[model samples]
Target chain A: MRVFQILTTVSYGDAVSNDCLALFELLKTSGYETYVYAENIGKQAERMGVKPYARLQKLRDDDIILYHLSTGTELNERIKALNGRKFIIYHNTTPPDVFVPYSGKLARLCSCGLDETRSLKGTFEGGFCDSDFNRQQLISYGYECPLKVRPILIPFEDYKKDPDAETLEQMGGDTKENDHKIKNVLFVGRIAPNKCQEDLISLLYAYRKMYSDPIRLILAGNPSGLEKYMAKLKVFAGELGLEDIVFTGQISFAKILAYYRSADAFVSMSEHEGFCVPLVEAMFFDVPILAYSSTAVPETLGGSGIIFDSKDPSHAARCLHEILNNKELRDLIISEQKERLKFFGYGNVSEIFMKQFKEFTGQ
Target chain B: MSTAREMLSDILLSSGAANVDVPVSFDDISVCGASSADGYLESLEREFSDRAKVIPQYRDLKEKLGGALFGFYINHSVEQQNEINARFLDVLREFKANNDEIVRLSNRLKELESRMDDNGGIR
Candidate 1:
């Protein structure tokens, strides 16, 4: 049987694109004809052998189409019209307000994506969601089809080793004073309003003001088209007279692994997360996690990390201070995260996917 | 003492008071008196009316309008403009709060000028 995957935009370093490519590999290994399609294909998409979505045509009854749904699009209507078996992989749409101050176009697209997601009540026979939070959202949207939870696919082994000498040097690892260690606080995600980099900066400000020990905060992520917001963050940091803060705008995988490996603790003040892949990555890297108790973060962490409910900068600062200073507490948190990471290992996740695929296809 | 223009600029930049040349004309006092919320709302209505008598009925007009008219320009303009607008709003609010005192001072100056005139230009 032929299996096809589709997405709105297949860009390099995107979580959905990574998931589709992994799924495509699995499908190909299983001896099924698989093709990937998207509206706009990025460079990585080309390497992954993705085709333009325009080639989607009338499919045979036995053929199956899998759509990686995140944002809103008119493609849902087209998917509903196709004569093949349809399946959806629901990636949660970001709340529109996150984009309001940055881009009205993005905000509208998110709002419309939510609307389109809601409108696709029975467009698919069944679907997979990345998290229970996203699954519940689909159910609330009146999706009555059978749905299963499949966590995002990440190459955990890529972060298993120590960062290369060049990457460590670039991130200021070697220049640090050997006499006294500087605690590294890291956050890895897109630099955007919803990710709450501003709030993280505020927490960093409070941390520096409250403590004498030197600390370096490394924010590693693509600016994600929020360059203005990123600039404002830098200015705000400057206004607060903050030092030792770095914004590594869109680094390579080696750099990402380096940030995680070198971090004393991973702190995330992001308000919105649809199964935050970075949280799991931090866990894989054995860095203790500190995240805002908002959205799917707590659920994704599954009681492994420190969850701060307050938005108060000082309160967040206090939590980070306590986590870094208390070696016993930090070790305990790291141990729990390692165990939690095991649940999302590729071996187990792939098994779950295969079971669902077999059940759906009845082959 | 700094000049009025320098003071205004200082106020625009930082919070501590500076010598600003606030024009306290008699007409300025009168203009403040006439600029109430009622008049402001009416002017807004007239402005909207002048733009287009018929408002298009759409479910997502804000998004549509932002995309069509301001999408490309406003995205670049928002960061700098937002800062200037925030500072301007702070100054405007301060001016509104001291309006009565400003009017009273203007009238007192006017009375002094009239008395001086009545005394045949103060001999």
Candidate 2:
């Protein structure tokens, strides 16, 4: 009659997995008997007490289960049949159509995942979503359960740890001085079409041709199964003669942190996002954010960071130039973002989540 | 100055005025984008052609000082570079085909061996 968390796969540093682990930690340290099970657990997460779902031999009828629902469709389809007091944490799936030009396999999975989300209607006793956009999605999908929108839990302590020194020197140079002429603009997320990485490269092109030559665009994310998309972007970058654009494919958590630390401004041209957790991450690192206003992006920023309504690379480039070179503007954006970031602090978010979790599960 | 929007508008307006006199060329860009193989080279060629118009003026002077280096390298290597790249691509394709055949044959052998083991057990 304890608590159990389940997901199809749990990899370290993944936003959904991080949220699951955060809730698991909060539950455990607060004296609730909680365990997590995943079908395919990464080495780091498996080492951190996440069990193989195959090893989950028995579950009491009264046990509470929190399922992390993301893009993976296998567990999304199976969670309903598992014997437990069920609830789903909905991390919205990317639109399948966005991946059609890149990977058929991923597109099919996302198409099926959304269908499964609809099929999961009325099955759960309760539900939760990371953002209001996802909340509205669940509503449209007919999830008439007791639902709540709690901000994703971030482990700020992990971000505070020493970033990879090798990555630091490779990116920002050996010395941490403002004397370096290059301004590094960064975008961190999955290198998928919905993220609009091609626009990032175009922005860098505009920035270089129009404003300054000594600038860099670091696109740090996992492109594990999206080789075609990555190749196309690389070709595009080459076509533009943009040599300073980097597509960092599948980096370590510390290496990613180092990129954030090295970034002068965080810019996103994404067309779709569930919550865009990296926006908050940029805030965490004090990097001023200049993002295109899209679904859930404005909601996530909550009037904190600079949200522009244009997708013209020229506009983004000019704003990026001003943000990078103008110290007064950059400081104002960061200070505003810092204040907004407190809303997503682990202490604040975890408290709301834990309070709701216990109340819903009758713990 | 006060807000990002205001600051961006300021830059946009100022830059807009500045760019009014400069007409950005898209002719060479279209031809370059027709195929990735020729994109970079074609763009460079257009730039070189523009600069070559000045080459006639300093022909005797700069060519005497090893300034024919660019023409010498291009005339010597452009055709050869294309040939080499095509050859390299063909070799890579052949290498991939050979690897695929090897994997297929190995898998077939394993299947046959497994069938033989099954027959022996039955006998």
lDDT of each: 0.73, 0.78
Docking class of 2: incorrect
Task: Please give, for residues A109-199, the per-residue lDDT of candidate 1 as tens digits.
Answer: 8999998998888799898899989999999999999999888877666566666667676555632222217778899998877888877
Which parts of model 2 are misplaced by more than 4 Å? A173-179, B1-123
lDDT of 2 by residue, A93-163 (tens): 99999888656778999998899889988789988888889999999998888899898888888888888
Q: Which stretches of candidate 1 lie over 4 Å from their true place?
A: A160-164, A170-180, B1-123
TM-score of 1: 0.72
TM-scores for all candidates?
A: 0.72, 0.78
The deviation in Å at residue A170 for candidate 2 is: 2.6
TM-score of 2: 0.78
Chain B alone: TM-score in each candidate? 0.27, 0.37
DockQ of 1: 0.02
Kindly report which residue pairs in candidate 1 clash with one another. A72-A113, B4-B21
Error of 1 at A224 (Å): 3.7
